[model samples]
Target chain A: MSDTTIKPRIEKAPVLERITTALPIALVPVLAVLGFVAIGDPAAWLTLTVAGLAMGLMIFIMASGLTVVFGLMDVINFGHGAFISVGAFVGFSILIWLGGWTASSSVFLNLAAVFLAILVSMVATGLMGYAFERVIVMPVYGQHLKQILVTMGGLIVAQQLIHVFWGPDEIHVARPESLRGSIVIGEAAIEKYRLVAVGIGVALFLAMRHVLKSTKIGLLVRAGVENGEMVEALGYRIRRLFLIVFMVGSALAGLGGVMWGLYQETITAHMGSEIMVLVFIVVIIGGLGSVEGCFIGALLVGLLSNYTAFLAPKVALVSTIALMVIILMWRPQGLYPVVKAK
Target chain B: MKEPLLTLSGVHTHIGPYHILQGVDLVVPKGGVSVLLGRNGAGKTTTLRTIMGLWQASEGTILFEGQDITKLPTPEISRAGIAFVPEDMGIFTDLTVAENMTLAAARGPLDPDRLEWIKTLFPPIRTFWESSAGTLSGGQKQMLSVARAIIEPRKLILIDEPTKGLAPAIIKAMSDALLELKETDTTILLVEQNFSMASAVGDTVSVMDDGHIVHAGEMAELAGDARMQERLMGLSLEAHQ
Candidate 1:
């Protein structure tokens, strides 16, 4: 061959996935330190810090399902909030029925009542999620615009159904007697309910991380989220996986609803929709379809929301949105984008 | 053709309004590499996809083991023992290399012997067994893609453009790997543009043009005949070399 012979150009193999970045993980602690420095008062700062952790964890629980569903199915489900409202109602109603134990001083009674509420709520919302997928989301698969409109309609219908079942008036859901007060540690006080929320949130995060990392089903899920078509091509039914994921996501939303209701001591048909603003922000900020990203995004938002509210009340109103904008400006695809192999 | 393992009879595939594959008729004999060669946009990829059931055949029948599978869904078609490695390689970048193979071994756990053999074949697979697939280079990902397809005992493997964009050294390695796989009596239907590798590994060759099979013959015949090569592929074999 002559030296002048044209040869096919060779491309150097890329060292890493395009979206890999260590920055998102560091942002959580960086935000904490920033919070500490900005607030200046140790007691107030510590109190806000715990509140932020609790809030961030709850959002992570809610956003986790949506992110995975978004990743695996490529289906935009605006109706996810309905599961939250239904979950809150279902859980709190179970609590109300156990009225005999609501005022009981025993910690077992309090925990039992709460546990029962969570169980029933998950089951209820899980079933609802199944029906919603079959009846609503299934038809609009791969059609993003239609998915948005139809799922939004589903949300409206769910909200109205909630009103029909529970009445139009907002309901007050008080924490169980044992979970009603706070423990004072030095100069700062932490609500008993908030502490419980923190423990549950962290434990749940670990469990989810373990499942995604070590389990076969979790492997399929991560793969399906990245490329459902490829998953199907590999001899696995992705549609069934999508249905299972949707149901689980709905159940998690229900669980979050119950905890959120207890945390706020209030339940209403509109509560889920209201919280969804933060949930969307977190999903967007934590690259869509990654539970870890969702968790990190939730923490950043929670801390910033709390800190900004303390520092500048007006900025607090749009703090999560502002954070989302800034994060997007930095990483257009968000932190830890689960890129489909192209 | 040594008792065909797969037969596509006048198969037509449509992706939305685009009629990509227009009545493709081909036979893939058992126990060899059957390379599908075509120019860009000639519907070679669509033919493989139609057989895999990724895109449904709007018309005609696809038969494997004498069973009609044209209307089958992708998963059912795969469960019937067909594995596809798309041009993109379809590696789940977020998943670990081991996790990727585990997912492909649908029937049961990965056989230790089989895994060891595969690890030896592709060292990066063993070295990065626990690392995210994203960490691997392009050539390594392609190796994993083929490895995943054969992780379990598949009846046939379909690979699209495996050597599409790679260094010459990697191309030689891939060609050798395909030849080694042939030793085990595995059937591979490869859609490849790299003529040198295709001729080196292919036992049977089908040339496609404008969604139709223009010629099918022994790989050696096509490789030895420069006139036939120009007529079928519109390029001389020497240029590819």
Candidate 2:
């Protein structure tokens, strides 16, 4: 064959070769974990998987708000974790005040409250998202620096406000009675709340994936993420779309917050502030603008941290940050970077 | 002649601290191509952008179909019988050709005649119906942009650089399609760098320099005046580069 014919073949090989080679590299981590379990302790492996899955789900919920804003509107909302905190508080208040339940209540009644709490918090968070976009975000379009500073300021104000309203004392939120007990599977004894959280997370991931794939609004959102200005030029009021995205994202974070509250059974005025670091780490590790990335990153961080705790409980927290730094060093844009095919 | 489809008077625009359009005055006779010719950054695209409310005119009156649209939003301005094709060939690349067309159709009814007319004008667009718009060649994107503008009941369409960075054959095709568009009731304001392309299709030619219209006349009258193109565009067409 001529050089011209050969050139195309050479160029095509790199793309295919990269994927084929990378597949084994991607499997190495999973296989390594499996091998460690097969030789040593299965309990350790199971514990790591449950912890990783739970963390991954939580990260997916929280990062949905941040990524949606970044992907769709190119707006970075640093105050997102505050929305999660708000959702937690709201859910707790609903269970305590409306459902008339306590830590000792039946799991079925608490479960009902959880559903109702999720509904109320989602709506409330959605409205807050709309208002935040309209009031704070509208004026600073395309000004990333301004958005960062303003949203950070919003976070500070929100944190202080939460402290003022909820008081300094950390409050405890109870899981349902049914979910309080531990389930023994093989040699691993996992709490019912942790398992339930994993289930909720999986459901959320599937639902969000479905909405993005199937709906007209989802179509608009995907298009908007790539080219919001064009979406506006096409005569669809993009402001409204931004608001919708903001609300839905905030609600997702709120849902995550509610879930976290149930898992920890504790809420504090600075609960949002404490988790913001981990949430951002998860988002950055997953990929800044991808949902799937959030899940993967969350899972990696969760499992890594849990395993680290097993190895050295005193320094488990450092493991997630170490993973984040290592990932950044390797892939500056994060794993599974949201790149469009040229 | 019947009332002009679109009219602009003393349209002044400022971007940030820079004064862009000083006082561009022009009128588009109903059902004709009015070309706005200028050097780079001479406010040709800015004039179209401002008219479409992409940048609100600092001072001026833009009337489309005998209605004031100076204070309207960009989407509202588009909805008001006026469509703008930006200089960059603003095609939503992530969307499929069909999806892009579908979104445009949602703006207003895409009459069968108009759709057929466009398909006849550019067959490549029809050929790549299901393909992603980003995958299209530059010339095809230009065709899609122009096609999008004229898809509805637009009294006037403003097209910016319909033949920028295109193969010679595609440029000729675009020029021919634009001329055909003029034959229909659609009025057009064209911003162009290629003088020959403008001259071939434009019924009336308006020359802009430093944000002001320096000359306005018929295509023949303007093209005959070599000094005007040199004085305004800073390059003489007769002289080979």
Candidate 3:
């Protein structure tokens, strides 16, 4: 270590810019208030809000990986949904095996069973993601049309494989003892699982933020997303960084799949593709490769979907599309757009 | 005789159907600045890029420290101790200045002495230490780009147009920074258009036209002679010779 005294840095706060950045976050609260007013009943609104948040957080988990992958290597893996389905099925198998623990009256045993299933599912999905990147994604780098066609083909094959293993039949699952019922607050009965999901989602969002903002790996990821070529020139192998990110992203999707399957209490081989519509919406709305953007977009879509489904069932079908259109019109590049190299 | 740190022989690069660098030859001497000067589309940027291994030369060899790096992947070329600051500066705007610097140092944490020295060279780096890179002014961004290149010790640096756009004040500061950087004995292959800045820091100069080096000699020779500037800047009939 050499001796050198460095000058201290002076902090300069730019208030206007901070406000501008924070405005998108305010949209969640604004939309929630609108939702509350539109529904006009505290109980119904609260229940729907919890459910919407849970759905949003789950979608954030899934879309988070896609956005980063899209942003970093510019790979459009339509095969991403395959990992989701695989995760759900894997977790479903584990849950079925641990049925006694899940059915047990002890909350500890129930949570322990669910945790084990999630862990096993994450590993299965993470490994599958690694293989998927090497086998399917590696060949189609920078070729948009081929990436779409090949990954979609991969998705189809994965679905077929799922059928081979889990059979083509839709699998139903029962919630664990502690997670089965809803908590009554005043007049509203909020599902315990929904609340738990919201907590996990918020915690995950915070954790992800910390990683992206604090860690060296996260810094490399953020750098890789913006200018991968530059990242390579700086002496780090970006492809390796990108591979790690791809695996982690896939693992996250796997986690999301498990959560989503449990939430719906049903698992189908085609479930991943069916949810792709919402995932794509969140990715597009969040700005490709932006985790924060994905989170907010997920929440907005989830909240709006639930609110619209409650307020106007007919409008709910097109609400997500309309939201995307409106957001695109407003920001064009999506919220929190990554400044790409020209 | 000054030692050659890098040498490119008969380098040619094709991007899709367009030929960017065609039959280019260059040599960067160790321990000082070698400026690659050219007008628009003279393939100065492409030459720097080819040397950095961003774009693989379709034909020919690029030997850095005598190691043939013609077909090496960009990351490996960089890992061989060559840093590149592209024309775009390639700053990750979303990341803070501190984060950008953190990514620059490939091996462990940055050296405190070097960090302090860089802060002295580019004052804006300290001012915007925690600020998002996107928030910086153009001059500050350029400073950050150069600072990033020197964040760690490297044998060679390939910089493309560090003074493309800026006020005279910023250019002077950049010129002063490069002059001071020369004292540390880092080999810099700078692609630039600003003649004054080029003349100020360059120990050796190579003028390019139509993807070929038209003139190569001491920077003083080009700086002292007005006729050479007009002859090589454009309409270099001797490029064939």
Each prediction's DockQ? 0.44, 0.25, 0.40
Per-prediction share of native contacts kept: 0.62, 0.30, 0.59
Runs of candidate 1 exceeding 4 Å displacement? A1-20, A339-342
For B60-173, candidate 3 gives per-residue lDDT tens digits of: 999999999999999899889998988899999888899899899988898999999898788878778988898788878888999999998889989899988786777778
Off by over 4 Å in 2: A1-14, A17-39, A98-108, A312-315, A336-342, B108-120, B225-228, B234-241
State chain A's TM-score for model 2: 0.87
Which residue ranges in model 3 land beyond 4 Å of their true spot?
Answer: A1-18, A339-342, B235-241
The sequence of per-residue lDDT tens digits that candidate 2 reaches over residues A124-143 is 88887777788888899889
Which has the higher DockQ value, candidate number 1 or candidate number 3?
1
Instruction: Tell me the tens digit of each residue's lDDT in model 2 across B197-224.
Output: 8888888888888898888888887777
Tens digit of lDDT per residue, candidate 3, span A1-342? Answer: 111222233445689967878888999999999999999999999999999999999999888889888988899989889989999999999999999999999999999998998899989999998988898899889899999999999999999999999899999978898999889999999999999889878998999899988899989888888888999898888888878888988988899889999999999999999999999999989888888999999999999999999999999999999999999898888888773423
Minimum summed lDDT over a 10-residue window in model 1 chain A is located at A1-10
Better of 1 and 2 by lDDT: 1
**Cα lDDT tens digits for candidate 1, A20-53:** 4566798999999999999998888888989999
**Best-first order by lDDT:** 1, 3, 2
Query: TM-scores across all candidates?
Result: 0.94, 0.88, 0.94
Task: Tell me model 2's lDDT, rounded to 2 decimals.
Answer: 0.77
